[model samples]
Target: MLRIWKWYERCLSIHPVKTQVVSSGVLWGIGDVGAQCITYSTARKRLQCKDAEQECKIDWKRAAVTSLFGFGFVGPVGHYWYEGLDRFIKLKFQLRPKTVKFVAAKVAMDGILFSPFDLFLFFSYMGLSTGKSVPQVKEDVKRDFLPALILEGGIWPIVQIVNFRYIPVRYQLLYVNIFCLLDSAFLSWIEQQNDAPWKRRLGGGQGRW
Candidate 1:
């Protein structure tokens, strides 16, 4: 663990963006694994109760796409966004600005911009990765985006309050990445909901597989 952190520190010193992206990908993959474990366990119990014959499998492609989105979107967005937020707060106030108003503004901005956008990206990426059409992806986005955003709002405000108030600017994205591991798991569960459009579409198209 010490050696790993040392190496990560080295990477951060040399190549912060790449390090963050790789870290985000690995963590997101772990999140998907966590999600899969919970889901497979539930499925396993149901199968046992029904005495049904089936194989529970991991969807590697979905996991890969989750990682891809984290690497491509989350790392970059959070890094730049948090940095900008920090700089803007200090510059806009021209004072040491760790006040309640500043933190609240940061949280609000994050909720406004990040929550809905990230949900849309997740749904769209998942849809396309699973071979859905553009229209299908749009429909899925329309169906899932609002509920996910609402959930995101409920969760991320407190999370970001802590993030903005305590974490340093350089490490804010790191803090977010750590938190997103569980957030990704929650999102994975949400995607599997009975009424989730992507799930329904997958069910409809299972005949092809």
Candidate 2:
């Protein structure tokens, strides 16, 4: 275990961006795999497959695309964003680390700026990746953005509070990536929009996946 850590640290030192991108890609791929597992179960139950031997095939391409997104966008962008935020706050506010105002400021900026943008990126990218027309992608952004943002509001503020106050700035994005692995799974499943249990539970909201 320690040897693995040493190897990772070596890679991270050599090329931080590349290492992070790869980590995000693999982690996000795993997330998509998890989502696929749930999706398969849901499909079998929903379809009431009579043949016990028949199994749903995993969509490896979906996981691949998810990894691609994480590699190209999420990890690289998150790294830069967190570093820039740390610098900006240090320069602008001059608050000491872990202070109340410092934590609040960090959380506020994340909530106000990054949350909405992150949702936009996820839906728009997924839409384009799945071959939706430009207009269609834009339409998807509108239909899903509000609900996603509402949920993010309920979820991320508290998360950011802990992240900002406790985790060091250097490792913040890494910390987020760990959480985001699971988050990506949920996002993947919800993005599928094919009679997902949550959708049915939420009264069957209309969404074009």
Candidate 3:
């Protein structure tokens, strides 16, 4: 753990701010793809045991596009929002207000602003790819949004508070990467739950495996 922390610190020292955020965002996106692929592939292999290789194919194009989007959109935006919030709360300078307020504000902004836009982008992509109707996709987005808020907003504030208060600006992406990895895992489970019907039709089975 100490060695890993040292390497993380070194990376922070060497990378530019934009580079760090971009790298972290790309990695986070990759993590999402990886988590989904892993879950899907594992289920396919265990349940079907046929054409598993084909089933396991990761959507590199989708991942790449989404990664670029994340790097361009979420990374810079989240970084700045965090910076501004930190300054607003004087997080580094004070402890009286506690971290809860800052966390609440961050979560609120994320739910109100960032999440809606993200859901739009994601649903748009899904609609285009699946030829699903706009209203159907919109319903899907509505179904997922609350869970996303619970997962993202609920977790991010605590993480951000620790990140803004303690971690240096240079290393903020490192904190985000760690959080995003865990988040990717959670989203993978959520996606699996959502995909159960598709999987059943494809596999003619009930269990995931």
Between candidates 2 and 3, the lDDT winner: 2
Q: List TM-score per model, in order.
A: 0.84, 0.87, 0.63
lDDT of each: 0.77, 0.81, 0.60
Instruction: Tell me the RMSD of model 3 versus the true structure.
Output: 7.0
Residue 62, model 2, lDDT: 84
Pairs with backbone N, CA or C atoms under 3 Å apart (clashes), candidate 2: none
- Tens-digit lDDT track for model 3 on 1-209? 99977875676567555755676567757776877777786677677755655646666765665566557665677667655755665555454333665555655665577556764565455445556787766655555545555556666666766765567655665677677766655554454466445434443222221
Q: What is the C-alpha lDDT profile of model 1 across 81-126, one tens digit per residue?
A: 8878778867886646568888887787778877777887888888
For candidate 1, list the clashing residue pairs, or say none: none
Winning model by lDDT: 2
lDDT of 2 by residue, 140-209 (tens): 6666666667766888888889999999876788788898888788778777764444544544445554
